[model samples]
Target: MFSFRFSNGPAAALLTAAVLLTVPGCTGPGAGQAPATSGPASGGGSPAGTASPGPPGVFPVPAATLSIPQVVKDVEPSVVTITTQTGIGSGVIYRGDGSIVTDAHVVEDQQRQPFKSVRVQLADGTQTNASVIAIDDPTDVAVIKADRSNLPAARFSTATPEVGDLTVVIGTPLGLEDTVTSGIVSGLHRNMPPSREQPQGALDLIQTDAPISPGNSGGAVADATGAVIGLSEAYLPPSSGAVAIGFVTPSATVTNVADQLLKNGKASHAVLGLVPADLSPEIVQRFNLATTTGALVIQVSPAGPADTAGIRAGDIITSFAGQKITQVTDLLAALRKAQPGQQVDLTARRGTDTKTFTATLANTSNTG
Candidate 1:
């Protein structure tokens, strides 16, 4: 199933490899995480008559430290809660003109229905109506427009965030408005498999340890200084004892897609127009392939880039552009970094023969 939020309330649902869980809401791709207020505050009040700790006993530092709480206060206003007819999720104000950015899966109905009216809850709890302007399903990004103005637009950082950098996620998670969770950037360039909502899947996702629940999708993932580094996307549930892995769309991609959507009503992504399968021992034996790694071309669209480059269905793509392609995801990752009309080199194997070709990229939305 797609990862969009479900119509039901926020609760962790059992998920199978086939069923993609949404952030929360109705049980789709993205909603938000559970509430951050799961427990009582630490260091509860001291006894009424107890005196403050003496100097030798070590007095608590007052206003002597910088903290994330201050960052939250500064950044929360740019995050918002988005509710459609069937689901609820989060979004970020991308422009003062009332343009908002969110996960496409959030507003996507069960049947991949057309855009519909949505209610946006701002940080101050003010509500406004919005219209879906453009959606890029391949990247799971969408842009919407509201009639209102003077919105709190989020500021983004251009500097790349390193692994282990402090991070905080802000969103309307678990139906909780303006929730904030803290963690660190744990990884980068993570590739997620295709789901019902994203046919080609998402590439180069920012991985974090922050608590991202069902409603967290489309929310802001800020650095320690409060500059948005990415947009919360999805989180991985415990598997084989592994836990707390969340993902986000990096700020660079967000800016590029949002800019394109605002300007052209759609975002452009390079397309190969071919079906690819990962090379494995089973696939190797089944297809009598020449290699046990790389992406196998199963079908090439007529007149598409691969077809025009003389790539056949039986060819194994070993590399694309300047990167080595070990699987279909590698090809996808490379494609995301390219633009339409860009020429890229490809290396493939046909039987025992290895050949190279240059293919011009094309936009999937343009072709369709």
Candidate 2:
């Protein structure tokens, strides 16, 4: 069995030695105590109504090369350390009114319940209380309103980061605040399938080698120009034979979800209303599938988008929109890029017959 763990807090006794991936946030009885482990686990501008100082990509990029020290100086003020009764994590100052952005899991208690209010520590060491505003579990993004204001909000980049772009991560890892690490964008559009350990299931993440660790969740992942491009989410532990492999939530998603949360106190996601699973060799042999690659429709929701489009359980999704669906993650990534109420074409195979259907995506609400 493949195992994944959340990179939260200092390394506690292994919840399960088999776990591989982890979200980097400290969660336990105390910030000093080792946090419990689990299996594998945006946006710029003045989000919606609240007007902040900086907008997305407002920072000026140096024409020649990026100065690491200068980048750190620009972004550190916008980064803050977040502590709850359970443990600590990191967050970014989202607006001048003290709206902070962080991973949903960061504010979740040991029981995975979100706290109504938590403690926030500014870069200058000023501590204040913050109330949970909204949380989008599917995307693992959350917004909290701090009791303080006149803060320097970090500039988020609207432009997609290239693979080789320089990346700097600033967060409180292992309860050490204001830690900074550097690396380059390793890849893009990386997807994580839904698992018991990480039900949220990330889509279209920015892969980086920025040494993300425990307590790094919700921290800033900035580009060469000091523009916030992503937030540290999870990392593959070195025991998994992985090195410098970490995943970040891209800025576009951060802003999109943050804006919705700020305006509506909820975020909407495009849902196809179907349960999908990866095809196994044994299942393929048993079913005599014509193609081995594709997401197997495990179950279809009645009256849901897939059901309405005539997609039934046992059909293998071969294509979504205009993209080939090699696996469930591909479909999820495609869905993430699509908007609710939008119509798209879907192709599937039943037995040896190929069929195509137009599906109107549905909306699902996630409120804090």
Candidate 3:
């Protein structure tokens, strides 16, 4: 069985030596632990040869493709090592004024609470204290403001890379600073289900063959032009019989969440006001579901959008906003694309009846 584990450090105790499948958040060195089995959950850039200024705080993509060494020289300065009380991880400078973006788990204490401040080590080995600006746990994105200034912010590409595109990962793995790895984009739109270890719920991630070890979380994954396209998030360990399979949080999400947190001190998510679960054979047999596939509405939040739309716990969500919902990940992905307060059509099957209802999505906030 293949298991997913977050590549952060101070490796945790091994739960089992057998083939275990679980996705735990990466922390410091030796922090590896068995992950819990879960079901599926849920760009950048500019054109070449343009002299125009890109988006604010973003660097325009270079016209020419860069070599691996060139890419490293371009991006390494923007990557930093983040050390919290519990563990160490990596981060990318997000702005010239010392704003750094990293995985939320990187700055969190052992109890998973965000620290008010942590230490940051820049590429040149300049160590400084950084205050936690905010954290959105659901998305696993966090922002911190270092005491220093005039940092080299990485140019983040908004364009989505195609499968087989070149990727280079730079981070501090296992406390070894300045680690670099290279690979190709293995897949796109990969969904990872929420687990106890990663409560960020279902995540839509970019799949790559880049080697991501512990302490690589929040590190930069740059493209051929040296423009960062994603942040290292998780990886399948060697014990899982998987090689070179890793996951990343796309730059689009990192920027979006960071922007929201910077603007409002919290990140907003479209909420349907219900708990969705995958429909199993047992559930189908018990509920006599009309279809064997779809998200099972196991719980409905009171006064939430779904509840207001008259959705019940026994309903099976078959579609959302005109998209077919084959499973919980589908529903979550659809929700990710939606904005709060937007009215959309949702279809569900209750017993032998299929019903469609219009729901105004609600907004939920996550803060540090």
Candidate 4:
């Protein structure tokens, strides 16, 4: 099994205690344990029209390049230190009206409730009381409102950064405010496995080599141009001792979810409402099935799209929308890429027979 650290920033003992008591089936990484898996590429390649310079890092840094100090000066003010009763993390000023955006897990207490009185500390050492406006649990995004205004909102870029592009992480790790670390965009669109805290899992994650430690959660991962490209989330450590790998939520997804939370009081996502298990050779042989690859429906939500469409347990899902469903991840990625109220075709294998069904996705946030 793959292992990862959520990178929450609290002292190891406190974090472990809190997590064990609250997050069911989720365990924090021990000192020497390393990640068991590798992540997908972030599409790092030479820019179009620019000749490949043999390989990355072959060319020297340009003389006029913006220094690390310049990046810190340009973006530090917009990053804030977020403290809850149980943990400390980071946040970015979302708008001028005193709204802040951070990882939902950062502001939530062990019970997953928004802390009654969260505190936001500005770069100037100004502390303001904030209230949770909305929390998107599935996506791990949250919006909070503070009493103060005229905050410096961080500039966000929807353009995905190329792999090898400079990535800077600004956050309050270990309670140290305005700390900055630099690395390259290692990969993008990586789909991390689901956890009890986030059952839907994190999709389209931007992977970087930046040292994202505890307290860097919800911090900003800015590109070389000083545009916010992603939000620091988690890291994977090498088991045998190697440089740890980090993951960030892309800025586009963060902005989109934040906007939805601001406007609709919740972030909406397409839901099929079915519990799925990966189909394997053993399962197929035991059940005497036809295909080796696909997701086997183990449970279906009543009145949800999947159930209403006549999908049943023991059925192997072969395809969803236009995407082939070889495993549970493919189905999840396809659903995440779709929108609510969208109708799509679903193919499944039932007792040596293949059946097709139409399903209209719904928002679990809005629907029962």
C-alpha lDDT values of all predictions: 0.69, 0.76, 0.76, 0.70
TM-score of each: 0.81, 0.86, 0.86, 0.82
Clashes (N, CA, C under 3 Å) per candidate: 27, 22, 26, 7
Off by over 4 Å in 4: 5-65, 195-198, 239-242, 280-282
Per-residue error (Å), model 3, residue 20:
26
Question: lDDT of model 3 at residue 63?
Answer: 64
Off by over 4 Å in 1: 1-66, 194-199, 239-241
Model 2 ranges off by over 4 Å: 1-3, 7-29, 35-66, 110-112, 366-368
Could you give candidate 2's per-residue lDDT for residues 1-368 as a string of tens digits? Answer: 23345644322111110111223343322445764343222134632111244667785443344589998999999999888876778899989999999988788764555799999999999999999998766777889999998989998876788889899999987678899999999999888775555433557788898887767888999887778897888887767767778889988889888989999998777778777777889998997888998888887777777889999999999999999998877787788788879999999999999999999887774110
- Residue 300 lDDT in candidate 4: 82
> lDDT: which is higher, 1 or 2?
2
Lowest lDDT block of 10, candidate 2 = 12-21
Ten contiguous residues minimizing lDDT sum, candidate 1: 39-48
Give Cα distance to truth, residue 42, candidate 4, Å: 19
